[model samples]
Target: MASKLTMTPGEILREGELEKRSDSLFQLWKKKRGVLTDDSLRLFSGTSERAKELRFHSILKVDCVEHTRKYVYFTIVTTDFKEIDFRCTGESCWNASITLALIDYQNRRAVEGFRRHRFQRAASEAEEEPESPEQRALSP
Candidate 1:
């Protein structure tokens, strides 16, 4: 039987170009190619070929700062409270895609936690319960 809990963590959800705001004094917007997977967002630099990966576990939330006729501005808040700014074409739904993927990843983690807790509780209960006569006979 197929398992509903099965999930591929590295599955690609979305891919596109984005404009990431730099940390320099001028805060120039630099173009980057983004690959959104089930567990992380990988941003590749256009000039340096370097990649910056932001895992879903570290991302706290995605905030939409503004929406203009030309672009959509958003911020990615990390677990440490650091914010990363980004913008993309008005028609490209990068922010929504990232938010949905992050939510899915978070939900998966929550389900796993519940499953683990339930399994542990069941095992403990079994250990504390008295064994049946048939079960005792089978034991070494």
Candidate 2:
């Protein structure tokens, strides 16, 4: 792995062997060593060559979970409908980690968004309503 790939900022969870599913004649499912972080997954063909990246926030869905006697396979679907496949040795935690990380990221975003919306709504409501005498006197 190159320093460039390792420099991505996030809580690095798993970094080892993961294979991308390829269907083309020239490309087949070949195993590659890459880095998986809380915010993104990055793969490289060579140490200095960047191949692909799947960022958690931009991901729209995760699908295609298939298990065999040897490995666990899954796909990370992006917002643009790009499906990137990944697999780890049998009974490994790679798939689970990816799913959980993405879910956690989404849940955090939802919480922040809801809080922001509520805060704005409260501010507007306060501006539209007159302060009661009790509140006014309590203020000063």
Candidate 3:
């Protein structure tokens, strides 16, 4: 399988076979090897040379549609509102894995964004604020 698809970088949170619903008129369920990473979910089908990646930044949410005795059905909703359906064995817990990874990625991005904005605001404020008269005199 490694020869069929190149492995993506990052920690592998989980990896297993997943059934994905095709977008064709029949909407047939096809089995594919799924690799869950910190930053993306990579799906490899058949002998394809490349894996289709669903990056964390582009993902909006994961909706658990239903859970049967044998399988757990779920949907991955993207930022553009496209929903990709998938199902895995009940014990596989692919949905939970993907959801957790997505949440972690989003939280990290939010914190980084907040820090950048706060630093920029502080710098602007410091430049705009007037120095005290005594401090100004001491600066020569």
TM-score top scorer: 3
- Give the Cα-based TM-score of candidate 1 against the true structure: 0.86
Tens digit per residue, CA lDDT, model 1, 1-140: 11225746576778889999999999999999999988899999876667899999999999999999999999999999999999999899899999988887898899999999999999999899998999999999
Q: Write the per-residue lDDT of candidate 3 for residues 1-140, one digit (tens) a residue.
A: 12113545586877889999999999999999998887899999987869999999899999999999999999999999999999999999999989988887898799999999999999999999998998899996
Which 10 consecutive positions of candidate 2 have the poorest summed lDDT?
Answer: 1-10
lDDT of each: 0.90, 0.76, 0.90
lDDT for model 2: 0.76
Model 1 misplaced stretches (Cα beyond 4 Å)? 1-7, 47-49, 131-140
Question: Where is the poorest 10-residue window by lDDT in model 1?
Answer: 1-10
Tell me the lDDT of candidate 3: 0.90
- Which residue runs of candidate 2 sit more than 4 Å off their true CA positions? 1-9, 49-51, 131-140
